[model samples]
Target: MAELRPDSANRHRTRVKIVECAARLLRAQGAGAVTTRAVAQAAGMQAPTIYRFFEDKEALLDAVAEHVFATYVAGKSLADPSGDPVADLRAGWDTHIGFGLANAALFGLFADPGRGARSAATTAGLDVLRARVHRVAAAGRLRVPERRAVELLHAAGTGTVLTLLSVPPEHRDPGLADAMYDAVMRAVLTDVPTLPADDATAAAVAFRAVAPDLTVLSDAERALLSEWLGRAGTGGDRGQRDA
Candidate 1:
């Protein structure tokens, strides 16, 4: 129906307006300031109208987070991958840290595991991180499995952000974020090769990409090969038990 389009447009606009109002309140006064009545007042609407757009305060805050993250990503200059996936990952890390620092209240909300699990923005950011990690894995710079690299990066980055935010601006260590990034990088990646060498980690990383396509192996055999390659790339023995 022709009327449906106008109604949909109005609804979308109102939803965005509400999200922006809530975001402003959140940034100015923290999460406790983001009640339904406060957001409705800030948006110049009645309290009950907020319910129509978002099921509850939690859902509304999630929208506010996505709005803030979308704006941050929009302002970022997307880097061109210059055939060096490790460098590319490093650049992405800086941008991520910058975004988190600039938006502390929003970051705090998403840093909480329970709240973060409910955030679409957090999930989207992780998806971007996964792509970056996969790029490194595909380029053979990663000495660990792609899954392990992703986990390490996510954990380290989030931990760094939370740590930085826990301290006040004047007292925060200037090099802490970079130091943490380098530590995680050392664990995840190997030096880029300039010439052929007997790097078992590199060999395993390169082979892992093609392991699934090796039709000679059955499903079981392919799975076994994958496990072996993951451990090989990690510079550890697959069969060894940790003490």
Candidate 2:
């Protein structure tokens, strides 16, 4: 067992070295440059040894993405929950955009739909976003449901990054992201004066709005509750109209 220790240590070191090399190549020249031959050469290992760690190029890229995104996320000076949830959310949004713009090459890897869905690091990032959205919900300010807000923010943020990256740096619109965020806010937030009034119809609608965001139920159960809530909210509105 003692003799096995040295071999295990060597393999771990080699794996890290290979991943680091692949990541560098990927960053320097995009995904096309991370071939096994290139990585092995960069890491001072035979091409066959590369397969000892990663099953294939996709697997290796996935590891590279996981490592890179995780490192970037860890490095962020994430803010603590504060007095204003919307301000907190905006801070997070700015940080997300900064990271994507700074790491365009690596950001593209996880942005691809085929790979993004399978990435543990991307999922972790979504969880963080969800928590931020949840803070808005907990503050009683999220006009849209929590899940819908998350989906909207994810789409808007990802789209903003990709759109900016598509343009040359000099031609890119500096205010586009802020404008998009404003559009999303306009659609998702309620003005204080026009918030739903305190009444049966309004109360039902409020309850229904959050029904889908509840986590106490399974997916099927949540779906059923959302359906029921929809009916209840509609019926309340109809009754109010009749009266």
Candidate 3:
């Protein structure tokens, strides 16, 4: 391996120091408490030296977010890709929740909607999630409706973690958190039908000619038929259906 030059290595070390300091302060306190002076003091450097590495506080926060995301992705490499989708989903959920629990304040700041400069880091994390979804889907681990399933999984995981973090520490119950996570996993992954609505509809159309009595109607006909069925099932007439 080629050796890193002294000046280049020093610069890299300094940059890491600044980012580490920022991450520490933001995590211990909050983003609002992270100031240039505080970070410089934490890093044991002159305040002006920070400007040499980052242009402003926003830039520093963005760098910290990117660092946090990179560290998260680097640490989460499970070898069991051939597992059941529910198991894979549950594992992913645990990893996400563990990160949030470990880095509550840091994650809050990184995910804050006000942190516009950190959008790139957020997007990068989402890209990693999207790739994971594709991998699981290609392996037939994920159910159909790949994009929707992936999005719902992401939403459910994030929502559970956030809910856990929002509870006061004194009142929080880890059992409840586990319950919520399991509930979301069941609703999002386990019980979902293998044939998505779109695919099912396409299948219906493909078999329509063979079984016209099966009613492979277009959207308008489907809506009308649904209303009619509702009325007929309830012993109501066309007037009630129209109503």
Candidate 4:
């Protein structure tokens, strides 16, 4: 591989230093304390130097958020999944709540609709969530469509963290996160590990999970099968609602 030129290497290092310093300020003192001057002082560089790496304060904050969130995601990705997918999903939910509470300022930054909608790190984190939900579906434990399961978990986790953060630490309910996770799991999961003989929706969901691996079918055939399964799952869900 080609080596980075000295100037390019120095620029990269300088950018990383700026992001690290900003992240420290964010974690310790919140977003209000991460001004350009403060970050420059923390990084031992002139304030003007920050402009060379970042366009403005918002740009710098965006970088800092990405840096901090990416580090968290990297750690999560490295963890070995437990053999039980449902248990693993719960573990992931707990990890998410802990991360959000620990990184209040960073989590708030992500909660901003504009910032989160455009954040690459946020997208990466969601991808990890999607993978976990996919595993549960593959294990035939999921009753809802994989996408819906992921959305429900994601929404519930975010809401739980934000609610907890909104209250003083001493006032926060320790069991709130657990309660939210349990409620979401009940909505998305089958009561039993094995597919229920009477639950057509659960069967369709389980079959849908493995449909992509049905190699004997052509791509078009697989796509058609998936469409049918999706409708079947929806219909079963509707029937239950009507009952």
- Runs in model 2 deviating more than 4 A are 1-6, 74-79, 192-243
Scored against the true structure, residue 121 in model 3 reaches a CA lDDT of: 54
Q: Write the per-residue lDDT of candidate 1 for residues 34-116, one digit (tens) a residue.
A: 99999999999999999999999988988888789766654443545667777778988998898788888998877878877
Model 1 residue 112 CA deviation (Å) reads 2.0
TM-score of 2: 0.77
Best by TM-score: 4
Which candidate order results from sorting by lDDT in descending order?
A: 4, 1, 2, 3
Model 4, 142-175: lDDT tens digits are: 8878888888888998999999999999999999
159-237 in candidate 3: lDDT tens per residue?
Answer: 7677778988787777865786666545434243233343332222222212324456677776656454434322454
User: Relative to the unseen true structure, what is the C-alpha lDDT of residue 140 in candidate 4, on a scale of 0 to 100?
Assistant: 81
TM-scores of the candidates are 0.81, 0.77, 0.67, 0.94
Better of 2 and 4 by lDDT: 4
Superposed by TM-score, candidate 4 places the C-alpha of residue 130 at a distance from the truth, in angstroms, of 1.0
* RMSD to the hidden true structure, all candidates: 4.1, 6.1, 9.9, 3.0
Clashing pairs in 1: none
- Least well predicted 10-residue stretch by lDDT in candidate 2: 234-243
Q: lDDT for every model?
A: 0.80, 0.77, 0.64, 0.88
lDDT of 2 by residue, 1-243 (tens): 456488899988899899999999988898999999999999988999999999999999999999989876655435467888788889888988988887788889888998988877788788888877766655556565556678899999999999999999999999999999999988665544124463333333456556667889899998777666545445534332211
The positional error of residue 73 in candidate 2, measured at the CA in angstroms, is: 3.6
